[model samples]
Target: MSELATHETSAASFALSAEQEELRSRARALVEREGFAERSLEWEQTGEFPWANVKALAGEGLLATTIPVEHGGNGGSWMEGALVLEEIARACWVTAMASLGEIGVQSQALAAYGSDEVRAKYLPQIASGDLICSVCITEEQAGSDIFSMSTIATDDPDSGEVVVNGGKALISRGDVAGLFVVYVRWSQDPGMRPIGAVLIPRDTPGLTIDEGRETLGGEKLYALSFDTCRIPASYVLARENGFKKMLTAFNGQRCLNAAISVGLAQGAQDAAVAYVKQRVQGGKALAEHQGIQWMIADNEIEIQSARQLVWRAAAAASGGFPNRHDAAIAKVVSNEMALRVTDRVVQLFGGHGWLKEFPAERFLRWARYGPLGGGTPQIQRTAIAREVLK
Candidate 1:
């Protein structure tokens, strides 16, 4: 066999343990019981975060599964976490996104870098879904180029605090987050270490949450502004090499993001298949048509391919931080694959796909974010190329 084939065979040999499978089964059951397909529309209309679902996931031990056992988590691997996210996303992208905050990059960052006191206080609450955390990295001018971020956090020696100033836009779950992991430039001097992240509470003085911006996916994206917001110096995550640490943790986010994309595509495909099998056209079901079969086949092929890429990336990062190059490649492929698959699903549904009465259109809308969030496809490709060239 060739090298690529051997790699695929080896990867295929890897299987989930019984415990992981049980976790996946429980998560799937919860999503089915919740009937998120119907409720997702309600949440979109009302612009709510679906706290009930969050609590439900927490009760099932699905939230923050990747957090270490020493820190009140299940001590699960990244693969297990991705599996949970996939099932949740298959139900509703909104709930999936909300769950990501608890189990994705921000939570990992706190677990990996937060002081012992900070971890003891917050990690349990996060794993229990009693608290929500938001990652504040994308600024008005620094969506793709994070180093260009203008937010600054300066330390005060006398007060033993840090004064934070600047704003973040397009932050997911920012409006409802109890904790914010805000990234900022720590120094003005050119040679000094410039980037760092600090924990800021929602009720911190001088911090303001602006009106929510409606994105293509209908999730409420908020802008957070910090005007001389002073937080205790002890809240600092990594003062010197904070940006590097954050970037490393973000590889986990990319893997989970890919899982969400794959799940959304799978959900859209499942909905389309169900619809086509029942809907009669010219005295035959839509599924009986060759054109429809071709579309369905194409979607299935891409979905399976995308899923393998996600699993590979997740596995690579199971023991420690994710392999940056693999994570970037998986993110780019899965994100774009979801867009293509969801678009085909919409087309397969014909007029009903465009109508809000069905879920296909919503899947298409949700898939659009896959490329934009967790670093754009262009950014992922750039990073991948850089790694390859080096």
Candidate 2:
């Protein structure tokens, strides 16, 4: 194991190496420089994707970390990716969301499964933040159940093309994504199998993206409709293996979505702690109160547990270890852990937490949205059960 991992067990308080220390400082500086603290309020009010900050992150090599250096990327590991996402989320959750779409799921898809031509065409653009992308799954009828997707793609024998039809709902970055990794059911295949994915350009004919709607998490999402969208035969990524490829992408995102929640919950905890120090209660500091002190202690415990679970999950994936079951458990616990922590922070703040002036309410909203995004807590438990019993 590397020195970082060796020292991480007993007391994570060990000093960072010269290089690791430099990266952490740089990452922290970037967030502060980008007005990440203020960006959340702006995104909440405007409901617009933070492109400028994302491009800046690209400039910082944050977006390029995971893609291999051979593909014009920095070739960092999942641990680095998690650190970047956490720091970025500390400043602006919306930026983290937008970045997660490109840096996490989209990059992984291109790196692992894309054809040589597709990788050559897209990976550099993705790393440089020149072209933003989004995963096109989660249809109107198929939120968590991928098996129920109605979107269908048919192969044309005459021209060797694939025609796509159906709508993708609540697609993050959908309205502005230059490229989309679209999942579709292969109509020609047996068993109504979900077996096709293609890279669809935004400029393609018969592809229209409606304006994105505002979500409670201050997310910008769109309903993407493909009416006989024609894609070159070369664009089929995985061909008859669509389900596996899509699951790969979803697994990455599910872990990532949980990380974002961890950051938001930590942010809420930080704000609450600061408030308790300054805001007096009963003529004494709120931090001194036994009840408030217990709440603070509980927040620390839950936050640590949640963060460790996320790190373990990230590390397992990076190390190519068996991580699916652990990833699901981490995602579920972190999701609910964050929910409870943030809700408790709000309670600690009394009336101020309920107001927009404080971030507790926002964090609470985001924590609630977490479980529903990747998959519900119930779905996660079912997945865990299948593995444990097997």
Candidate 3:
């Protein structure tokens, strides 16, 4: 508990401790020094992976924050990881997303559930930035409804291997990842009991990655086809009944996703503030006008509120993964909050906000990712409602 930076305000405010502040500062400095903010959109435009951003974050020990220290990582709490994500996102949403591919759901599932052989072989490499992981979950029928997912994995007892066949859509980092954390169904049953996950290295014989589709954030989403992709049986991360466990893993993911949303909104607000104070309207700085001031005030209020929700989700995970309820509410609030805040910032920037050269549009695009990335706000609301109904 002491590791988390708690505040005096209502015991809910997520105030930064000296160490957390330094960690946040370290992430910000790395982004600034690398010119990540300036070159943030280059990855999408050039269709290149942000390897430099990945390497820089990996070099600074930020990429390995979610993995346990025993695995050659920082063993930081969810809060620490959220802090790093928020700061990096504030500067460059692209870099922050790249960082998430390392420090987010796939890394978490592999670290928390992978077999000893799998963990030993990959965790060190993952911590060192020598390997990257992509989580394969969504499919044509399976974005929010896991029951509709068609990806399947089966045991081949005689071969000492597991075989997988099915396709995944909208997979992030598929082009660059060395490993894939695939969500699969072990049985045709119509319930969570049949759900499980497995790990397949990128070089596996039967796996094929399609040319990616460019996204609003400039990162590409890929389609993956596993034509009887087979790997050692040891590659299984979770067997039957694993969906419940992985849901726990995803709780942290929702928090980090929310953290990134908060960052994008805050970044937009920051940009708006600088612009408003300088850009004149009616012979006066925009900041001098009461209307502009209200916008700024509204942005701050929303940003602060979203940050606290994200932090609460992160901090509550100290006991382990956050309970689904907290993660759901936080995710819904933060995701929608980002849309409102960034939209306001875009309005504040007026004409410049529509241009690619300005950070405003980038932040806006980045903010759009939050609600869809972890889980849609609708899905989160359903989860929240489930808790409320109970």
Best candidate, lDDT = 1
Best by TM-score: 3
Q: Please estimate how well model 3 matches the true structure, expressed as its whole-model Cα lDDT.
A: 0.84
Point out where model 3 deviates above 4 Å.
1-12
Ranking by lDDT: 1, 3, 2
Off by over 4 Å in 1: 1-13, 189-193
Instruction: Please give the CA lDDT of all the candidate structures.
Output: 0.86, 0.79, 0.84
2 against 3, candidate with superior TM-score = 3
Model 1 Cα lDDT, one tens digit per residue, 156-229: 88898899999999998977899999988887644326888999999999999998898777788999999999
TM-score, cand. 2: 0.92
Error of 2 at 252 (Å): 1.1
Each candidate structure's TM-score, on Cα atoms with residue i matched to residue i, is: 0.95, 0.92, 0.95
Per-residue CA lDDT of candidate 3, range 259-353, in tens? 88888887888789999999999999999999999999998788778788888888888847877888888889888999998889889999998
Please write out the lDDT profile of model 2 over residues 166-247, one tens digit for every residue: 8899888876689998888886454434566788999999999887887888877789999988988778776666676567
